[model samples]
Target: MCTEELATWRDVSLVLLAAEALLTGLPVALILGASLRRLSRLMVGMRTVLFQARMYVWRTGEVTRRAMGMVAAPFIQLQSTVHGLCRALDILGWR
Candidate 1:
């Protein structure tokens, strides 16, 4: 093989070996890390959705009172529950 191809193969082999080591010693870390990455991505998506929904409710300039605000609260609360995983979920899951 060419010199550059040989170098790339060696680098890839090193990475594979490191991954094998990690899997052998810290399989849970890999699983939890993947889970955390997914959670972070979900939070990012939820953040964008909540931002747009809040902007829609506020900038409409038509729903600026108790009834409108109350109607908006449930949606906001739903988003909050999702974002925060709710008080109960947090308590149960963390413990």
Candidate 2:
């Protein structure tokens, strides 16, 4: 082929290659943008779940402490009753 024809062919090839690159890159860019958006949403959801779990644990601890206090009340009352009986027996000369 003549040099002028070869140059024309090279120019055409370059233009076609650029067009193909743009066409291929557009979808890839869109897919990556969508993926990033989904990842952001997932991160936000994870943070919410973690915060809720932490609050649940904290509330559970508070409930457990209150339950223990309730369970100890009878024992405390029994001790007080026993102490009063001991004093009464001592006063009655039943040591």
Estimate every model's Cα lDDT from 0 to 1: 0.86, 0.96
Per-prediction TM-score to the true structure, in the order listed: 0.31, 0.50
| Predicted structure 2, TM vs. truth | 0.50
lDDT of 2 by residue, 12-71 (tens): 999999999999999999999999999999999899899999999999999998998899
Q: Using TM-score, give the best candidate's number.
A: 2
- Predicted candidate 1 versus true structure: per-residue lDDT over 1-95, tens digit per residue: 69999999999999999999987879788788999999999999899899999999887765567677888889998899787776767788863
Model 1 misplacement above 4 A: 1-25, 57-95
The positional error of residue 70 in candidate 2, measured at the CA in angstroms, is: 22
